[model samples]
Target: MSSLTPGVSRLSQPPTTAALTARSSTPVAERAAQVRFRRAISLMAMTLVAPGTAQLVAGNRRVGLVAFRTYLGILALGAVMVVAVALDHGLALGLAVNTTLLFWLNLALIGAAIGWAALFFDAWRIGQPLSYSMGHRRVAVGLNGVLALGVAGVLLFSAHIVSVQRDFILATFGDGAASDATHGRYNVLLAGGDSGAGRWGLRTDSLTVASIDEQTGKTVLIGLPRNMANFPFAEGSIMAEQFPDGFDCDDCMLNGVSTWAQDNPTLFEGSDHPGMDATVMAVEGITGLEINYWAMVNLEGFKELVDAVGGVTLDVKDDIPIGLPGDEVTGTIEAGTRKLDGFETLWYARARYGSDDYSRMARQKCVMNAMLQQVSPASAVKNFQGIAKATSDMVETSIPASEVDTFLDLGMKAKSQQVATVSLVPPLINTAEPDIALVHRTIRAAIDKSEGKQPAQTTKKAEAGSKAKADTGTDAPPTSTTSTTGGSVGSMKDGYAANESEDLATAC
Candidate 1:
């Protein structure tokens, strides 16, 4: 046609076979390339959705069947566990504190991670990357690697966290049998203790009893000052036998009970922690509530616990000094509602430069309240390792492994309620010779109020403020005749404003 163009006034004819092939070859090639690329991605995707499905169809069937069976078995076991936990919730808790179970769980996770990763690699190999274009091969490999690493990384991380939890439970929780609640309440003695060279061994500077309702979980925090004196021990207790009538020795304050027990351990037979047992006796005697368990925290190492929970938020009523009396001040916690770090929170709870011990007790109560209310479950999970490490290192408790989950649930319940507090400090009760009868009655009333068995009573701080205002015929803060303590909002002579409050949050 080209040569005879002038004479080729003839009509156009159908395209030649070569021309047709030339026209369709590029499009056909592109479509074939697309099909191969799609097949590669589909194989990888099948592995992601159902771990050995790609291999079952396109690769070795034996390996695929084994992997698929393992995957199904794991899923079925998980479903069975969910049903078991639903029937007996305590089974989950038992597993949580079970080191043996945790160990096996860790192993299973690791094995699953390795097996799943192998399946992904096998699926990748079956994709036959060489059959695809260079660009398609690169994309498919990247996707396979991401999927493998992501799944393996998650499983490995879970194993690591579970391993940490197991270690923590092993070291921190004891294998003692759980104790039943006393009178539908569980009373736990919490103390902040310290020990050092050339110092009295294990002196608890802060002592408080958290009496929790067995059903409702409402709590009454009864704080006994470290300086409290002339208290009796529970009848038939070692301390009681030692001091037939009461602990009336000169300079033998409440906090010294632990040191005294440590000095004479022979008196506390069958007890691993003689000092803790002695303190429990004293707290039981003072509060008239049986101690279900005790948890003592090392004051120096408590900062780690605070930091582990991402620091607790507190209201700093005054500028609190970081150092003890006569020591060089390093930092100051300024007044106002503040979120405090570990160091600052430790000082806030222990600071007493210008403030007295009573104010420190009040501040410690504030810290306990803040920790209970502000520490969310999300924070616990996010900082689980830090928390586990800190607790293992800092806390010494007699809580049985079985009771850990019960208390955890109770604590969650308490967090939503307004906590009631009563510290046996000045004005309300004389620390030097505290009225034992009054202490018993006060503790009973607080617990009753928490259980809703008794009507609400005004806090001692309110009563003192009213009395002071009545005396002065003014509505000013009860700062009459003296200025406020350096680190507290109220004077030592007047009751600590935070000592006995119906609602601790506002009182602090």
Candidate 2:
């Protein structure tokens, strides 16, 4: 009862409250100064750890705005990645795009970080011995040491990023797959598949040959129509041999064979054509060029990649407003130079109905040209992080990362070079429908001529008098050449002689 009656002790007097009030009554300017100093220290610490924080430290309003934008952007992108990688969508179209944006943004952040450190050095320079007394030299040296250490740390991390990326490319695509010795002049056959994203299963939806010659500094893009007929597999090779029926004279269309490869995974490895080795060989046989690298991408992945770049622009040849089975519908647009969003562009590329396959091929090439042109240094700098993110999420290729820089260098060098486009239309290269057999072998020979490769040398007669007899209409003797099959030329499981005989007749 006594404790309850005694409410306030001397120690618990209202003096503590008065003291707090007095402290709170300090001048607003002084309080503000203290708060600002505390904030500066906090920001510096945070900036050192988070790349985006460079904006706050560099005193670069433009970079600061970019960093702040990226901070929020990354959070949103992370959510999209989660949806694409974890949810049922599993790197769905939307998520893949978000991831790409994140990549480009992240790259920009790295550049910003380096800039911030440099800014700090500049600030320190303002008070250096060069401008002041010897006494201030020690302070300047100490500050320089600190700045150097910070810069070294940032560079170390940037190196790690590059190393990780290189390792990833090598593991996924095989080392030096895109090297000049292996993939001369940068003519890469790229095929986009249908699988959504990140999944192992995929098929070629958009097929093209991307060629670049650094010596001449030109990049040429050639699209291949999916329905082009009379595509041959290597003699008794993997793609044709996987059919288990020996080389099928009936299976001439490449797309059907690809579909067949998809349905029978045991015969193939993944959901793609097992005969791509053969396909490349066939292209070599036709184009007469030594094709060294091949890349396959999925349509979903391509769409995601395009969107990740905030969409691409292209000059339209004509108004395209049509819908097709198994294709996403892009709405109508006026013909002229125009920007294409992801789905719209994809649909436009796939809009080949009523148009010949050659026309479709041309459209695809147009899209690629637009994309490459759009990849300006400014665009790359602006959307660096987003590009990295999308590349991780939306693509799977056989080209390794170490080779990426080499390829990019070659690309940059060739950005201004003139390019040649070739298409094998009706009379040039004929493939019969249903049976899908080639009627002429010279066409394949001509393709080789274009690619700077010579045709198989013909045996000379005993005497000049043996001057080649008048050519007959019948097929010529077997010639050693590249095969569309998975094995090397002349290694067919079936009797090599018989297979070669058939190859000579088709000449694909």
Q: Could you report the Cα RMSD, in angstroms, for every candidate shown?
A: 5.2, 17.6
lDDT of 1 by residue, 1-508 (tens): 3664675554566678998999999788777877877887888788888888888899999988888887888789999999999998767767887788899999999998998888888887877777767888889889989999999999999999999999998788778989999999998899898746654237989999998888878888899988888899999988998898788988999999999998898897788999989999998888888999998888778899999998988877778878989999898899888788888998999987877888888889888898899889899989999999998988878898778889887887888998998888777788999888777777777777777776345444446678888999987564322234655556667766567776888777
Model 2 TM-score on a 0 to 1 scale: 0.52
Q: Write the per-residue lDDT of candidate 2 for residues 1-508, one digit (tens) a residue.
A: 3453376676765567878877877766455545544444444444444534544554656666675676567679778877666654323323222334446645665765566565455444332235433444455566555764677577556654554443334334544434564243656777666664343433455566665654544554444555555455444446545434332456455444445554556755552445455455445433444565777655555666677677877655566765674566455655666777777777666665444454455556556656765778677646655565556655556565435555665666655543444344432334343122231233233333434567453212111213423355444433334331211122222212112221111221
Question: Which one wins on TM-score?
Answer: 1
Model 2 misplaced regions, further than 4 Å? 1-186, 196-202, 240-252, 262-275, 281-288, 325-330, 433-508
The lDDT of each candidate is: 0.84, 0.50
Which 10 residues in a row give candidate 2 its minimum summed lDDT? 496-505
Model 2 deviation from native, Cα RMSD in Å: 17.6
TM-score of each: 0.85, 0.52
Q: Candidate 2: what lDDT?
A: 0.50
Who wins the lDDT comparison?
Answer: 1
